[model samples]
Target: MHKRLSELAFGESGTVRYILASRHELNCLGVRVGKHLTMITRQPIKGPVVVAVDGMEVAMGLETAGCVSVEVD
Candidate 1:
């Protein structure tokens, strides 16, 4: 099912469909909606995740997580 980034949890896997925001939001955080990102691992509470993007671990924040929309892969 399609869900927002904020809805994702640890051990959850999905794909980046597209971002739904203005250019301001993009500039504020150097992230594009269509960017391919996968959750590697997360913290106990709310924190950044070790997302596998282009074979790199990009630490993303809880807020930024909303930028990525993913589906079960």
Candidate 2:
């Protein structure tokens, strides 16, 4: 099912299916189609979302996270 990355709960795993941001910028952070990620945590007050991508933890702002579509696994 397609859902925003920010909508994923902690410890939930998902595969990146789409990116709505600048591809180059998202790519720099290792976000791309077919990449699997796991939600680690989200800071309070609409803060950044921390996700595990390719064995590395990546911090993405709520806006950016909302732009990423994922398929929950």
Candidate 3:
């Protein structure tokens, strides 16, 4: 199903399909179309969402996470 990064549960995974943010920010994190990512942890109450991207851990804000679209099994 198509879902936002924020909607993914911890330990779940998805390929990044779209990011509604600046290209610089996107490239800095290596986020792009078809990039695989796993949800490591989602902070409670408007916190960041930690995701594992190619063995790298990155924290994304709730707002940014909401704009990231992903396809999941």
Candidate 4:
């Protein structure tokens, strides 16, 4: 299944298949579909978990929990 990168859980890993953000935002972030990512853990020592994209870390919001669609290997 395909899902947004923002919906994955901590320790959850998956490849980005697509992003529905605005074109301007997409270009600014340099993110695109098919990018592989892995959720490391929540950040701020109490905030949302962190995800890795090409070695870069990104944090996910708690409200958007069901945004990413991942496939387990």
lDDT of 4 by residue, 1-73 (tens): 5544444556667765544445344434444556677877755534664667788876556333234444432
TM-score, predicted candidate 1 vs. hidden true structure = 0.61
On residues 43-68, what C-alpha lDDT tens digit does candidate 3 reach at each position? Answer: 99899989998899989888888889
Instruction: For each candidate, give its TM-score against the true structure.
Output: 0.61, 0.94, 0.91, 0.54
By TM-score, the best candidate is: 2
Q: Which stretches of candidate 1 lie over 4 Å from their true place?
A: 9-12, 21-35
Go through the candidates in order and give each one's C-alpha lDDT: 0.62, 0.91, 0.87, 0.54
Collision pairs in model 2: none
- Model 3 clash count equals 0
Tell me the deviation in Å of residue 43 in model 4: 5.9
Off by over 4 Å in 3: none
Q: State the TM-score for model 2.
A: 0.94
Ranking by TM-score: 2, 3, 1, 4
Task: Give the clashing pairs for model 3.
Answer: none
lDDT of 2 at 51: 94
lDDT per residue (tens digit) for residues 4-62 in model 1: 66676655667667766453554344445556556677655787656666676666666
